[model samples]
Target: MPSSWTVLAVITVLTIYFCKNKRYRWFYIFAKTFRRDFRGFIVYVKTAITARLAKIRNETVVSVFESLVKKHPEKAAFLFEDETWTYAELNKFCNKIARYFRNEGYQKGDCIALMLENRPEYVGIWLGLSKIGVVTALINTNLTNDPLVHSVLAGKCKTIIFGSLYANVVKNVAKDLGFKSFYQFHESTTKEDFEVLPEFIDLRSKLSNISGDILSSRERVLADIQDPLLYIYTSGTTGLPKAAVVTSIRYMFAARGMTFVLRLKSNDVLYTPLPLYHSAGGMLGAGQAVLSGITVALRKKFSASNYWKDCAKYNCTVAQYIGEICRYILVAHNNVEPVKHPVRAILGNGLRPQLWKQFTEKFKIKEVYELYGATEGIANMINLDNQVGAVGFIPWHARWAYPVSLVKCNENTGEPLRDENGHCMECGINEPGLLIGKINQKKSIFAFQGYADQKATEKKILHNVFHDGDSYFNSGDVLVNDEYGYFYFRDRTGDTFRWKGENVSTAEVEAVISNLTQLSDTVVFGVEIPNSEGRAGMAAIVDAHNSLDLHLLSNSIKNNLPSYAVPMFIRVMNSVPLTGTFKLKKIELQADGYDINKVNDKIYFYDTKLKGYAELTKDIYEKIGNGTMNL
Candidate 1:
């Protein structure tokens, strides 16, 4: 029972002693660990709060577009070679097209097929369809014959729009497919009244007659957030492309999430050379810009020499990329002033961890929002509040989750094998796994627009896993999750093949080879070596028409890939046959693999002793096949 003052003095002394000695000692260690986790938790909480707020208000993408038109009328909405369109101009253009669609008896939920390239008309058609509540099926222009005909008929499109440039491609396939009507938009003509071609309606005249003020009626057309807005086709690893029905809700979510992740503002200009047909260009790049009222600089295709020049010319603050595009840009000749552009950030997927630091340092880009998402998959990974080289984290959800598992391959056959329980176990951290999105009836959000071959669609749907009754979408991609829950891309399951005791992905090897300008498109696969333990890496390339610079090509591969992963044989071909969707047709190439005696193509083998590729003669082929030559 000490006096109150004496007790207070003792407590103060104890506090001071603890602060000076034991407490401070523990505080340093605690703060180091706790601060990182606490900050991560804060980010998680903030994201959750924002998501909840968005969900409560139910803000749709259509509403956001309308608001942009109202708020920023003078800002650039779309740009062509010499013409620039403001939001006001774009809104009017879209309404005119929408009114034409309505006048032609098109209704809500009707599907319209658009076969066009990267152009101003593409944006107009997209916005017009959105205003009319019609689902726009974006068809890849490169697709030909059956696949092309199949994709359009599969969506059950009421109308099809094609660029005048693709008229030949459409004419080759259209007669066979029973399309209701064909509409053409000619890029060469700027006339208000366009010439009407036989069996086709000109869009220009329809657009000229409609009033711009008709956009006020958009409120009635866009009343529902969950309505289907776009149908994006994703090529199946097995056969035909399957259309993924994208809703307005998903588009709105992507726009909001990307805007926050990229920290975009109205003044920011996003440069995209990727085609609008892909999700990366349409939903991520264009959608994000529209939502944030930012300007977008569109290019028909990517050119390495002209890329930095474009950025500088446009004063581009942001750019989007895919993995191959970045590698190609890096392979270009080094410049003393590589960081001359105004680009502050870049956002996209497929950027390899190895090139992360080098690319950022060279370009002087402060932020790299490397994001991950499938064209149709519900789960998306954004590296907003995380480090570079990581695809960011997704918290565990019992109902809906992507539980990745490594496919165990046979040493002899190279085919995936199942365990005794018939269940695949996931790989350890940083190891590759075939990512499978667990389908729980309670939480699944993706809807597959029926494929032309419905039976083909059924194959993509995996069923009865982890329970008596369950289903999931097979992503066909190998991925690994680190301890922090960041997903890292490994390889596509079908693309991974055994090569001299190593698993090789054509994409990984092709990515390395594409760095060589002498090779326009390279396809990597395994060619059987007689009496070998596994298949050896072989590459078939479309030469860049210059003398084969074997030394430069070999050096590039050696720098990027492991020794075993490098191609042992190289075949030079005039052209690489690609599917309608621009994806390399590997099945035929793998079938006709590297038998120099049988095949007509000029074959070259990597001469380790010579340090360059040399012509493969019958004698050398026999020696290599018999394991006499140490390849």
Candidate 2:
């Protein structure tokens, strides 16, 4: 047996070795994260108890903002470009807007549509509307023509407040939208075809007479927590966007929850480039700041080239992101090389498992708080253990409080599979299935505030999902929970399909392809093969400068993915467009298929004999169509 000194020496050596190894480092982080989360949980319990004891009612976000304003009057509330607004300044600005809305005869429960870019004004408008107990419909700025009109109408918004940036687009839909009033901000073009309204500057100029008092202001209304605050539109994959109801309670929970998750302080500066319309940006980024008395640096758009510079400029301790933003930064030569930045933690979703370590080490970030939740979904998962690729954990100890369960789902139909007894089958550990959250109104924590459209809301709820009388909100996302109770998001049900009698996850394939530095952007979808029984994997790639090496790419993909999982077809283009929230626009790509004549971009397919991609010519297409080629 070794001596005590020798044993200590051996333990020290092993510890040093494990610390250097990337795989073993997470154990330390997980330990620290676990402790921090436990402390935060205790704080949350105390806060909840205090709120319950106080009988907090008719409490709006404005009340919370006002409280924060009192605490940190001189602190920077918003930092946009070269401008900065203090807490008191922002409060007074919101008060003026609230007064103006009241003067315009806007009442409680009235819906107002706002189509603006990521700016201080956007946040101001949202807060101003909320202060007056009015629900603001945050319309996606990318929407044009019919989709724009449809989103506003779907929310039942009588008034539209748009930015001058979308003047032409809004003008096109103004006449058909039938909005009772229209307002624009900054350089709007007037059209005689429709009823055009004055700019926000004019309204602000007229509202100088309004009082800025918080408690005594007549414009301020005491709104119940259950009352609607925002009508956030969802990404319209199948049809026009549906407005999701976001209650004051849900918004407050998100703000407080994120603050707890990040362990944020009043001094923490959050830098966010994501659009304000998205929940990740609205609630977690700026919203968290509003509740915590922290400063936020809001960027107009995400620029990979300037990301590091912006973070350094703002002295941001926390940054917000989606996967595409990280991928873009990693691909950019300047960003791939290390640069000085103050960002310590990044909070958002869609960080790929493969790029997790690379992103952290390259950027020198401490935490990557990946979260999984829809704008209106009842279920929300946050990764507290710094677990790579996991959206959240469902520890056996706490699973009772968070009643989220995964049920078996058919990959082909994209629906939850019901057992013979008419009960939804719950998936075992490590099994990918549809995730559902129990909706109990009495509990409040598990409550679901669904889409504004009643039919759409009804479509998302799975009645008697597991039991005969219980209700569950269908997440429409497939996830796999491990034996440790850590849940990993697999893919959206609609994005996964059956191929070669196996389920192919588009996200999994995309993660593999995204490993290539040359491919700036990529979208994966299942395309129908003429002679095949099921759909074949296809990738629409954005390769600027067309510098992708086919042989090297084929080998990398082959090593990363299974034979059937490998995308059989590749479409290289100058650009691959993304939606407003930075999600891939795959509907058009799926419709276009692999038709060479229909698409302007170059198309290629795996040539087994050549062991690389080859030009997809008409002759090759004919051979594949007739089952002469074995793919």
Candidate 3:
């Protein structure tokens, strides 16, 4: 028999040999990152297996919630500001809301539009509606005017429930939506809460009844796993927001996948400040907590100033975020150690490469579960190893099982390029391309439950992607997968532009510009240059004071952004146009461009020699048109 010392030497040699191979290294690192106690691993295995089986076999999200509630009735389910609600308490609250919904003659299959901010009532109302098999249309709270009306009307909402803060905005469009019922609720009831128009009914009065009828009646309407439980609005970039169907099964799969992948436990507390109207907060953050019987700390709105303090106060082991949130937090505090908290992991989408390592190391975050998915997207990814700049990784063996794929695309047109045979070609490794997911109708699990509009739904399906009759859900986002199967988000197809023989991600450039304290908001896009081969970067900046120091702004951009990515033209405005979801409305910006005659905003051009922004007068514009003025 080999001695203990001899065995140790052999193992060490093997470890050193394996560490040299990238594939072996990734596997070893993954195992090390996922390492847990024997008992914990066993529990994870059992839970994952059970959840997978349940998801595959079609399980309702409400059933899962009820199961957890029964298992841990006394457990704290949610923490919002100074208030805490246990499973039983939340269950009772939801029952009262359900009762009110039932009294209004709402039944299974009904759709109710909920246009409210980030509050505990948002979750309660959604759960109550889900309990009665009524689909809840989560409208973006920031929406008003046409977009707001369009969303509510598009969903065919029977009623619109709004918050007090948006009373005037909703009132302005009340005549347009007079056909639908309206109800209002305030974050806290005051004299202002009761000062709503007659058309807007107060929802607070209905909350007083706590009969728990839905619980004991045993006659509550239940939906199938495949039935729509929620209608989450997509961030409308080009048009009005489309309501994406969130089936109970989709929620189940997402919740279970996150719980299993993150190793979430009952003791875990997720501090979520992302809006509940979106999937990241409403589904991923809340769903994981429901399935794992963990607590979720809610914030009225995401405040970079209060983010760390809230995590520390709540003892949050896990936190959620978006790319903007992380960037803002970093920019808000530039100290060596920006935050000191109990957070072990931060999970969500949109953590850019430039801010990933900087934010993590500075804030002392151990892991970042960078996620990638759309409200209407068919596939998802989760980073497990805290890989800097990677959205997620797929193990070699599991690649065949998942429907995700990347295909070559035309960056300028935001379209997938096809071969001579009219079939989409898969992109080579490390080459950024359109991310898509296979839609197999035969396999229910692979089927895409698309938007409520059939025309809109059909538009996203790409036919004959690989072969005749084969379809794939167009993700509309550009990504590249490394040799180790780690995926990095490049940019959205529409937001990426080719400039100076290179592609520039508007999101990346925007992140850099956002770090500047002078600019409150900015929209970056490609604009036409008279003699240029492709579009040149142009930024529409919003500053309240409108007194931007061109030299300072130019210096900041030069230090952070690439030469090609740097905006050649800058337009200063009092306000930045934004969609309901806070996404930049760039259509008008891109159209107006640098034409001083057409645009009223002040425009400046980068002078190569001067190394700063110079006013773009009519003479300079004419010179540039004549190809005399250098960029």
Please tell me which model should have the higher TM-score, number 1 or number 2: 2
True-structure lDDT of candidate 2: 0.77
Per-residue lDDT of model 2, residues 1-631, tens digit only? 9999999999999888887845474565466456645754664575455334323654567778888888889989989888898988888878777878887899898999988889887888889888878899998776665556777989989878887677667777778987656776552223433332442234434545777666355657878878898998774223346799988777877777778778788788999998888788898888965777889999988898888899999999999888667866877744345689988899888787877998898878888998888888878877876789988876544667778899998874458888888889988879899889999876546778788888888878898786799899888888998756678987565666545533466766776687764564888888877534357889998888868887888987875565767788999988877779887778878889898869988899988898779999999988988867878
| Winning candidate number (TM-score) | 3
Write down the lDDT of every candidate, Cα atoms only. Answer: 0.69, 0.77, 0.77
C-alpha lDDT of candidate 3 relative to the true structure = 0.77
Clashes of each: 1, 0, 1
lDDT of 1: 0.69
The estimated TM-scores of all candidates read 0.70, 0.73, 0.74
Q: Is candidate 1 or candidate 3 better by TM-score?
A: 3
Candidate 1 residues lying further than 4 Å off, grouped into runs, are 1-58, 189-197, 215-223, 333-339, 384-389, 394-424, 440-458, 495-631
What is candidate 2's CA lDDT for residue 300?
Answer: 88
The TM-score between candidate 3 and the true structure equals 0.74
Q: Over 4 Å off in model 2, which ranges? A: 1-58, 187-217, 236-238, 334-337, 495-631
Query: TM-score of predicted model 1?
Result: 0.70
RMSD of 3: 11.2
